[model samples]
Target: MAALSLALTALLAGAPGAGADEPADAAARGPRLYVPDPNPDALRQVVDLVKAGQYRDAAGVAAMVATPQAVWFGDQTPAQVEKLTRDVVKDADRSDATPVFALYNIPGRDCSNYSAGGAANTAEYRAWIDAVARGIGSRDAMVVLEPDALALLPADCGQDDAEGTRTAARYVEVNYAVDTLEPLRGTRVYLDTGHPGWHAVSSIVPRLIKGGVGRASGFYTNASNYQTDDANSWYGKLISSCIAYVEGGGDAADCPSQSVPRAEAQAWLDAHVHVPPSRMAHFVTDSSRNGQGPWTPPAGKYTDPQDWCNPPDRGLGARPTLRTGDPLQDARLWIKTPGESDGLCLRGTEGPEDPERGYLDPKAGDWFPQQALELVRYANPPVL
Candidate 1:
């Protein structure tokens, strides 16, 4: 089949009412975002921490350091989630904040891999999507439809779990999300477009297209992963250009000068690399743990350099928030949601797991109070 990335470019470019002259005020208001990664488990911890009066300790820190609004689901059940989503959307509308959504749970998602496991199958995935859509109500909210769901699919992870027909099932699931969510009165749903380091523009665009980007609001470039806002903007622009090109009738098969070869593509990408603040349109980013990027283990010890495997000394990225200055940019989002574990933590994941830290203690998605302390450390002190 044509590469998944190409399909993404085409699919994502075809959202309903795109390029439809949004009001200037909309830009001024920017996209409303729900952040710090939207997992139910992590959000619950945040609530617990907040209730304990550790506002500076957890989600309270997120609220203080990032955007005031936090997205919450009513419950995991379809009926409850549906009601909760609408209520949250209404709350966002009333409070003048954006309701961000993770919309997790796709069958075989994470393919029983790290952050491993989710919904039983496609039908269940669809139900969850429907509930999320219903929850959106008729208010303006920004939804990060699904994280890593499209970007880190079967092929990307080396798992033949969803190849061919199964992959097609994923496409169906994603398209369902786009069709169901984007139509919400004032909602703009952005599909996950992994980070700049993970997939080439040509490769990822098709994946977005196939996953039904054409029907959603737009495809977001970086979510939860760190690659600097500067990097995110340039990457988003390049990818956006590719999608726009395809939507205008460009063939997905054509390499477009950049993707002809890996070396050439890398060179082209390098020259174009920059995180200008201008490119954040329908795109959103995860500012949670990116205050510092992927933690790199000291070289030579671990055989491999996949810092994304979970590294030490890595602090939070830009604080998760729903505000940003760029008119074209949607919102500076906390897509990853701070305090959630990145993976089953390790003292750096290679070899024997560290006993003191255990298998999942230091994972990226965990709620680390020390990490929050680091975030506050780096930023200019509060004026008050």
Candidate 2:
């Protein structure tokens, strides 16, 4: 523990002090996770409410979004990215916190969906990644690399990579990133392993392997989705078990799945695999909008569920923390940056607005006021 503290101190060198009134013993507790300066739009809403004498409401929203969160780096120029990265690391160091960064610029990101747009080609992506790495330098940073890079491949989305060239390039891009970023001494890289609701343990294990999970720190689940912590943890364990099984010369097809009964699955692991916790890959889950678990659309309400996208009444999940007790679980993170929109979700309806909400939603990555308030109001653990 002392060694870890010292490493953290080294990483936070040149960082500013937390505050003049901070307790002297605070440093003994190690670094807190850095929350990037709040979004301007959210802050403006707070200001507007305060001006209108809506103190309680303003306070509630402030409390919900003011906590430590990630800084996303996507589609910016190399120089812009470098400056932003260094600035964040410097700020976190000053505040005695550890910074988390999300890298989302793959060649064919999101398969031209709502959040579509990436580098023009593989070579450009490599250069962009190189710039990010240089900006990070030797700082102690945690990176959630390229969300959906693996789960939504070009081939699977009916992209014109018929010869598998684009799909092949996607793998190469992720592998290159793992190779480049994993070597940094104080850096930990986690590949995206889509949410448990989308990919079965057996299915994603192979994709994770192909995308270089073996070389990465581990994988992350439920980014920008609303799956409960219990469900996400169970799903992660199954994936880790499957990976260990395959690495030990067992077939991935034989692994227990999330659909299996819990006791039955545990029984299979107990009877078949002897691998210990340390042998399995560690994972993190997005707890930002899962406080109430997943939303259940009125039965048969729509032709397609689209449950993961901007569902109504979802609350905030677990608070951001590094002290998750499970040995194989590293942390519970707000990887989705709550209050950001999941695109104008049509949910398979023939209209410009969401059928459930009866209104148009914000575009992807835009600040969402109504949804943001709902997250705070229904927050399972309570925002306060």
Candidate 3:
């Protein structure tokens, strides 16, 4: 008990409202996004680069790999998940820092794409979520639940049952996760909202409502995508406003989208809603690779843009932090681990090699040495 108290003290010491006026047991006031275990492949790359006397390259890689970022939990059994979660929390407890977890095991996750694979069914998914909750047990952690779960539904991807069984199952699965995880005293749950580039405000607001956004801490954007921070903040604000409108007896269909002029959208919100920032939902963004603000394929180049796939020359964006000045924008995070691969992108080519780079790309979650070096070299704030 004494040790835990000391740990909590250390964790809260630098937090806002932790002065003499506040109670020692008060919850930390600001963003507390957790940084999980670093990817081993990234570490190995660092070592290899250093051994080859690539000192500048080694420093750049180290700048990214050494930072604290969210840990991902996906495609693991219940027992394996429980142990991993416990280990992360245990480490956070020792270090006096919060932990962030990306939970990605919804049934039919990723729309059967390159990162395809999830729990076999809703039952299996619930058991997996249950195990994750048990592992968390009341620890202070941020949970980014199920990337692409709502955005790339089974129906949207042509993977759904003709009778809508799979679509219905998807909603149930997300709501089940919200119901299960949100009740934990110290856990903050955020639903995935694709990104600014993909879903419009009018479209995703209803999905978030049906998927239990009200019960969650907030929704996250740009999870494993490369959209700029300005775009993401705009998208998130519009979504939060739309949610407020819907909660106050307005229709989501009436809300403006990213397509609308910024002034017009704000004017529409101003005319219709009176919700305060404190009352509305908050959001986080994955600024992992938005430094260059998304890749644009050469015009008339390919049938499919595949922009989200590993684009060449993308850079790291803002570093991870909870102290974002905007009240509605909670934090800018490295939700998509930098230096990780986004699958072998063919980019409308016939061969296995990527036409954009003239090389065979790494599979999802694998390390790409060339891309890793690019990220470090072009990091937005500069890795060095």
Candidate 4:
């Protein structure tokens, strides 16, 4: 999972270019979805669709698309990185869209795996952050600051690394990212909080707090993992509520309970699902390939749940965007680029390539070319 950190560079594919400013009130502006552009073919396809007046279709595709790119470990020179960002932003400007930014290069990125790469050290990482923040070029943006960096800190998969210094370093790195990007004109940065399925409310809340969730727009869930919208919503709400309760002087353990019967939980979740866009501020979702929702393994599939490893028949989920009905919920985004390999399942490395037969192509970022082409054909036949 740490391998995901390598995507920071790929994720920063866009900075600023053009777009109408959102209304002062985000709600009045309606639900604004973001589409990150890294793959040119996919970007052009969506742009063409939007240009053709297919807003809903475009939303369906771009809403939860993730363009989080490779940064820390790869050999992305300044010029190359800038070009990628410019290209993505250029396309976004033409499409009148804002790309969701996923900043995942925390110090111990991927814990020394193939994706285990960064700016040589903390100081270098900070400088890289500065360039990344600047590359955003003062444009309209929604950012997810570091994926598993916080979730997997001292507790999760992270190494204690040097008498616990690594743990402290992670915090500093996150704060720096928040501090750097928060001041940008219209950027909203959400720190990482492992999906509800991954961490208990108490467990995540503390980590988020340390990771600067309080200062950030909010914390994010379900990056590169398969959690249903219902699940994600409840997880996010519970975490948000827990944060609110703790901040308001409630006991950490007494925040709330989501372990009632499934029916009861769903009922409670339904009643509280729409917290209004204002309350949420802004949250993002990975609509890359969750349409059919998460994948479930058949009998005798594997020893461990195959959720982490790629499964089958999963379609793209809700589109990613800033518009959420619940006042508390901010933006819904595709922080995880779809189609990008979720790492070689066995080796734990996510490549930028796509698989021919699967939920989404691992190579094409998040654009489902096959699916998109089908829509294009349905909407407009070849002009013979």
- Residues 299-351, model 2: lDDT tens digits: 98788868888999988777776767788888788888888899988988886
Model with the higher lDDT, candidate 3 or 4: 3
Q: Choose 1 or 4, whichever is better by TM-score.
A: 1
lDDT scores in order? 0.58, 0.82, 0.83, 0.57
Candidate 3: misplaced stretches above 4 Å? Answer: 1-33
Q: Which stretches of candidate 1 lie over 4 Å from their true place?
A: 1-75, 161-163, 251-281, 304-306, 317-328, 347-366, 378-384
Q: How far is 15's C-alpha from truth in model 3 (Å)?
A: 23
Error of 2 at 150 (Å): 1.0
Q: How accurate is candidate 2 locally (lDDT)?
A: 0.82
**Would you list the clashing residue pairs of candidate 3?**
34-99, 34-100
For each of the candidates, the C-alpha root-mean-square deviation to the true structure, in angstroms, is 11.7, 7.2, 6.7, 9.6
* Regions more than 4 Å wrong, model 4: 1-95, 257-282, 299-301, 347-384
lDDT of 4 by residue, 87-147 (tens): 6556665655666666655667766643455556678777777776667776766777777
TM-scores of the candidates are 0.72, 0.91, 0.91, 0.69
Winner on TM-score between 3 and 4 is 3
Q: Who wins the lDDT comparison?
A: 3
